[model samples]
Target chain A: MSDNSNNNAYWAANMRIIKIFLVIWFICSFGFGILLRPLLSGIAVGGTDLGFWFAQQGSILVFLVLIFAYASRMNKLDREHGVDE
Target chain B: MDQFTLNLLIVGATFALYIGIAIWARAGTTSEFYAAGRGVNPVMNGMATGADWMSAASFISMAGIIAFGGYDTSAYLMGWTGGYVLLAMLLAPYLRKFGKYTVPEFIGDRFYSGSARMVAVICLIVASVTYVIGQMTGVGVAFSRFLEVSNATGLYIGAGIVFLYAVLGGMKGITYTQVAQYVVLIIAYTIPAVFISLQLTGNPIPALGLFSEHTASGQPLLTTLEGLLSDLGFATYTEQHDTTLNMFLFTVSLMIGTAGLPHVIVRFFTVPTVKDARSSAGWALVFIALLYLTAPAVGAMARLNLITTFYPNGTTEAPLSLEEIQNNEALDWVRNWEKTGLLKFDDKNGDGNIAYVANGEANELTVNRDIIVLANPEIAQLPGWVIALVAAGGLAAALSTAAGLLMAIASAVSHDLIKGQLNPNISEKGELLAARIAMGVAIAVATYLGLNPPGFAAQTVALAFGLAAASIFPALMMGIFSKRINNKGAVAGMVAGLIVTIVYIFLHKGWFFIPGTNSFTDADPLLLSIKSTSFGAVGALVNFIVAYLVSNATDDVPADVQELVESIRIPRGAGSAVDH
Candidate 1:
């Protein structure tokens, strides 16, 4: 492939990963935590429902994991694309 | 030792430690001053970012807000932390690869316009200055309550300490001092929390203790608290009260705002490489999560403790009498807080007992939200030293954030405005001197505003977040992702977003935040159930739409700027931040 096409491929792959993670991000916080909270109200975790847990604690933990996981994934992708500094 | 003397010793020791760190890490060059010589390790950068990020609002007020707002306020916890994900994936690595000293430099180069850079500087200063005023006031409150000094005296002392480190050492100084501050603050925050957690749930970790069974009642802690609060005619602790649309928008506003703030963005520049920048954000969220995860528990537990104190035999029994509050040793926290006038009691019906009902007429006790965290140690009956440590931690939180904001403001004035625009031919040393002078002026302005705070002092955090989300975030995001967004499009988008958000805020919060000039209130918002704080997301949507329409109508982006976008996407050849 030409260098331009190679760069395009790398960018596409990175965007794919980001799209998946963004979905998970939206699902955990805005989805489970807020909008669809009533749907999960029947399933209890500790004293409250799953939605309440996600809102107060679970979403924050997921955010930390998402960031770290994204970092490592990007690092691997960078090396694969010969873009590692 | 007495509590006041212990507070003095601990607070004094922390100040000396910070000054020592600042002196050791003093900046001698423009590069050192701006980006900490690009030598900070990613993990260290994370810790420093934690200290820089969690302001007095986070340290002193967040738990109390959550305590009162309950499930309705989880937006804060999610919004603040979730923004790190956006920063890491969308902004951090690319900005690091581009390699600049300040956020505006990236915008200026990416959009290929000085006008865009100037607009960014305005948004940055507006958000940061408003944010700093809260910190200065938090410092005064912390000092007066802990060290037995007057509020004005505390403000002056706080300003002097920040001046010594920030003007002398710059970013280099602030970074190391932030690391030390992070240690003092996290320990100060968590130690009392552990005690309270153990006391309430027989669990050592405060985060898990939130989920564990309440030791006293043999029920889950949250379940017990909810039952108690409901019995007293308050909203259930685990249920939502606000409109879902407003909550969603508020969370979105805060997420984008956190990603958009210039002070937080610039911290990414201090790390060595693009890879480090990506991971550094992860590290930052980790350190921050230590406090963030604990905050909900602190809020729940403190609320539980407060209610149980008022109604010692459950909500069905008589409340604590005035004589009991004065004579009982365990209720000393109430009397101490009472002297500050933040916690007040009035027997409206000529009842000797303190009534804390949900309704206005029957509720004789008016308790400020801030007292929850400030008096947590005393309420839990922890040792005097622990209370002193919280005082020191509050100051650390306020000071570290103040220094970070001062750095952002000083660098924008000296580097972006003065060097980039006005005097492009100035010498390096001249710019450094200008940076120091700008920092001093910013500190003075921050202190003055703190002392004579605008009517919107309590609402500054929301305002700061709103402004940053509406104005700065979209501009930076577009500059990176879309080569088609030309200079005019970028400038127009930012201006539109800023104007709409600010006008919305001013309409509800008075013109220029002065009292009695508002056409609307948050309670009866101008928009359809949308408070001004939640309008940033809408403004951001407007920015995106306008930028796209304008970009399509006008000239295409130049060929070279396209290459710049592609280069930043890849991580190769990332280097130290350039001076220009």
Candidate 2:
């Protein structure tokens, strides 16, 4: 029963992490990149605005970081939960 | 050597390399054939995934789309790469831990319903088959332009080569060859980009060079582009021309669609462990981003180069006359493309000079966007070898993706439909034979479709993403994340998603794309500015909604099924993937 409770706790923590990352993913790609692009138009990035940079190049960079961050965090989480394969 | 010979030599060398790699990595068993025996390294799998994921559209048409569409085309850039974040965090790891040979197998066991599994297979086949048709067409175009053959002959040769490698080597063969392909394609893509960027901006890294100062004009690239465009009576290059609603939904659709694709999902299955699956997606995105990052630069710089080629001084100079275009030796590339009827320069006013406007009358220069990337080297006056390398790169992009999609289709038939359902009593040897036979048949059907495409393959590729997003993504996410979704609810949700999306697509794109069959045009869409291509997000939302509401009315999922979900979520005891 204790093992079951501990397992639930671990899974809940994982979900929390997934949810947090997903929100970041949304903000980087859709929020900053597209919807709020006009607000960032005044701030120059390279020759273009911040939003255009975020859309074409910056979003992809953030996506790469997000994946690696999730992977490293999950691996540590797996160890903590004693679920390491 | 002459230019033709040089082109042939470079392209043939790449072909030999691929065939050699395929021969060296033959599959010996069903495990090796289907999942590459689950022994692939994470980075290698990532490289292969990168090659497999960047299909014909990304290679052949994306730059052209970006060249014309400008600021509006960010949906493709962000949507395509953004999906990997979802795949790594939401899908790949858990699906890898599920340790199945096929996605439908996971769906079957999770839903505990053969019918639901069959629906998943159907959706997979529909998406994959449409995607392969586009690749085959791209292969034909690349071949015809470079090898100096007819599109038909080129397609035949392309089909034969794909059949040789894909049928003989299976997943193991495809994996290693895809790695080689990634190298060939990236080098082929970036070399020309570096040259063009260096020519235009002093920076060699194309991504940074896009916004950097233009060396020729001594102005910011984007600012110069906007000036040149408005000078030509076109829209400013930096403004949002399309509705934010359409752009937002389109990006969401492509993101979910990328994560939901069966071929891409199966690549993760080839990696050895769940941890590898997580890391491999990151590496795959890095490789994919290498080209994707350069594409906009290639597009923008190519367009600027094109304008300068016409003027030689700047936009203020008179456009090249029809006689100059026809007789000038510098215009040979334009003439060559014109012979294919894809490029046209009409002196609409008979002023001799060409006029290209973003919209509204008095337009004379009509260039197919797909030809821009292919014509970039020639437009920039790069050497013959660079042009030849682009041919090989385009073929690599199309063929690698076609093989991957064909593999997914074959496995769905052999593993999911035949072995999983119809012939559970089949022997292992028989299953392997079936897989090979299925691959051959898929290639043949794809070739036929390529020869006589339904005219909507490109549009349908967007629909493929819609279907995958609407159906597969929701079900798979729910399977692991929520045990409350019963089999009945999944079926209901999938059906609803499929029907709504297909109906929406057909209404706007035409039923089967028979011109007069469309109920409404994209310009005057029935659903308040939502294009058929952008309907996938709506479809996905409907899938989730219908799934939750229906599942609430049904009995709860079984106890052991709940346990199965829990086991997949934790990522433990994952050794070799096993069958139910």
lDDT of each: 0.85, 0.82
Q: Local error of candidate 2 at B576, Å?
A: 1.9
Complex DockQ per candidate: 0.85, 0.86
> Which candidate has the top score in DockQ?
2
lDDT of 1 by residue, A1-85 (tens): 4878888889999999999999999999999999999999999888999999999999999998999899899889988988888
- On residues B1-580, what C-alpha lDDT tens digit does candidate 2 reach at each position? 7767988899899989987876666534444544552576777877888888887778876887788778888988998899999999999999988887788888889999999999899878867776776777677667767766666777788888788867775433457788999999999999999999998898989999998999877989988888888888877666798889988988999899999999899877757788888999999999999999999899898888887787666778887778887898878888877765557787878787786666556778888666788889999999889988988898888888887788788889988999888999999899888988887887787777676543333344666787788878888988988989999988888888877987887797666544567888777888878888889899989998998999999999999999999888877887775521
- lDDT by residue (B1-580, candidate 1, tens digit) is 8788888899889988977776666635545644552676778889989998998878887888888889998988999999999999999988888887888888889889999999988888888887887777677667657755566777787778778867775433446778899999999999999999999999999999999999999999999988988887888889988999999999999999999998899878667888898899999999999999999999999999888888887789889898899899888778767765567898778778998878888898987675578788888889999999998898888878887788888889889999999999989899888988887877887788777544323346767888899989999899888889998899899989998998998898777666678899888998888888789999898888898899999999899999999899888888766542
Give per-residue CA lDDT, model 2, range A19-45, as digits (tens). Answer: 999999999889889998989989997
**Steric collisions counted per model:** 0, 0
DockQ of 1: 0.85
